[model samples]
Target: MNAPALRLALADDQALVRSGIRALLAGFPQLEVILEAGDGDELLAALAGTSVDVVLSDIRMPGLDGFGLVRALRARGDATPVVLLTTFDEDDLPLRAAEAGAQGFLLKDASPEDLYEAITRVAAGDTLLAPVPTDPVRARYAYRDTSAPTDTFSERQVAILRLLAGGYSNKEIARAVHLSEGTVKNYVSEILDKLGTRDRTRAVLKAITLRII
Candidate 1:
């Protein structure tokens, strides 16, 4: 038997953008937009009674933005995965979203296939992030000090960090590094510890900030 369609909740302050996304998603029969909200507050209220498989939220809403929404959902013990949509590739937002428990992040102009893949991946308990170029990441998030104290990662860990910033999954990273998934997981944990962050996304951001990768 085929799987049921996944229900999605969309939250964006702009009505036009929301409508555009809704129309775009309407083409995919496997996904359904069950609820729409203008901000995080409305999104949370709407989610209280609805069963949604994923949330696609704008990061800069007027009240209770995307990060705030993730925190709220986590506080309520709602494990519903969230995919933050943003127009700007802000340096700090990715780390903030990761800390707030967001499972996915994508640019507003991402293709339909990219959006679909992100939703499906996050729904399946995987994290997804839009690939950001390393130059812009370094320029936007890098600190002035070339020799920072936190720049202590092995060459293999640095390679893994680069893949992580490119949004590669643990399995994918394992394949790239020719290592087992379990070993890759250990490397990721070590990388996070070295960066003083708790998640892959944050580790990537910190690595960029410190020029570790």
Candidate 2:
């Protein structure tokens, strides 16, 4: 038998954008948008009664933005996977969203395939950070580029860094990469040192600025 469609809730202040997304998802038979809200608070309230497999939300909603929403849900022990959407101008918000317990992050203008992939992966208990367009990110923080190292990350480091951007903890990263937690911690420290950042958020931002992830 076929699997049931993945039920989804969407939160965005703009009705048109929500409608457009709803329309786009309508084309995917395996996905369903069961609820729509104008902001995080509204979505949270609706979620109190409605069950959904995933949430696709705008990062800059009017009330209780995506980061706040993720924190609130985590505080309430709601583990429902959430994908926070951002526009090109707001490229830095993805790291914050991930740190706040969001399971996925994607550009608002992401292709339908990317959105679909994020929702599916997050729904399946995996974290994801979609490929960000480097041009806008580079343009936003061009000043920092000169300081960024010319050295490239190994394939393994890049994978771990992507998970870091998805907000995975050391333990989670270890499990994902089949390494010990201590090893993951070491890798994280190395990544921070290479990026010259003191924390995961800054490391991720620097990676984006340098077009490394």
Candidate 3:
């Protein structure tokens, strides 16, 4: 039997952008755009009555933009996976998105294949670390004067950091790295401390922003 279609919600201030995305997603029958909204407030209002497997939202809406949307969802203990989209690929944006509880981040110009992969992965409960552009100036601006030693991660820590970037949980990371789950947890905590972050998402994004992983 075929799998059921993945229901989706889209929120963007621009009607044309929402329509364009809805139209693009039309090519994939398994991915359905079940609801659409103009901003985070509208989306939240609809979400009170709607159920969706994933939310694909523009980062900048007129009200309660994408970061706020994710934060709101998390605050309500809603675990629905959210993928944030933006035209600007600033180094700090992905970090901010991660910190806000977004499961994935993508550039608006990303190809259909990329979009499909992002939606599917996040729907499967995986966080995604977007590729960071190489810009030393911007990198310095984003992570300057941090207490974390940028160049001090050991090889083992680096390997674990890479797996964290791939959104592996403690159990998955333990299996991949041949460590106990407890050990993985310890390593993750150390990684966060080394990166000056309070959570796994921020740790991974900060590592990427600093070119540490």
Question: Which candidate ranks first by TM-score, i.e. highest?
Answer: 2
Writing each residue's lDDT as its tens digit, candidate 3 over 1-213 gives 999999999999999999999988999888999899999999988998888999999999887999999989989888899999999867567666766877778888877766887888789866664532235433543653345554487656866775676566778666655689999899888888777788887776677666674
TM-score of 3: 0.65
lDDT of 2 by residue, 12-78 (tens): 9999999999998998999999999999999999999988999998888787988888899899999
Q: Please report, in order, the local distance difference test score of every candidate based on alpha carbons.
A: 0.79, 0.79, 0.79
All predictions: root-mean-square deviation over Cα?
Answer: 10.6, 7.7, 10.1
Better of 1 and 3 by TM-score: 1
* Model 1 poorest 10 in a row by lDDT: 128-137
Sorted on TM-score, best first, the list reads 2, 1, 3
Q: For residue 163, give model 2's deviation from the true position in Å.
A: 5.4
Give the range where candidate 3 is weakest over 10 consecutive residues by summed lDDT.
129-138
Which tens-of-lDDT digit does each residue in 54-134 have in candidate 1? 999999999899989999999999999999999987755555566577877788877776688778878987664433334
Better of 1 and 3 by lDDT: 1
After the best TM-score superposition of candidate 1, give how far the Cα of residue 44 lies from its true spot, in angstroms.
Answer: 0.3
Q: Give the runs in model 2 whose Cα sits over 4 Å from its true position.
A: 89-91, 130-159, 163-182, 185-213
How many clashes in each structure? Answer: 0, 0, 0
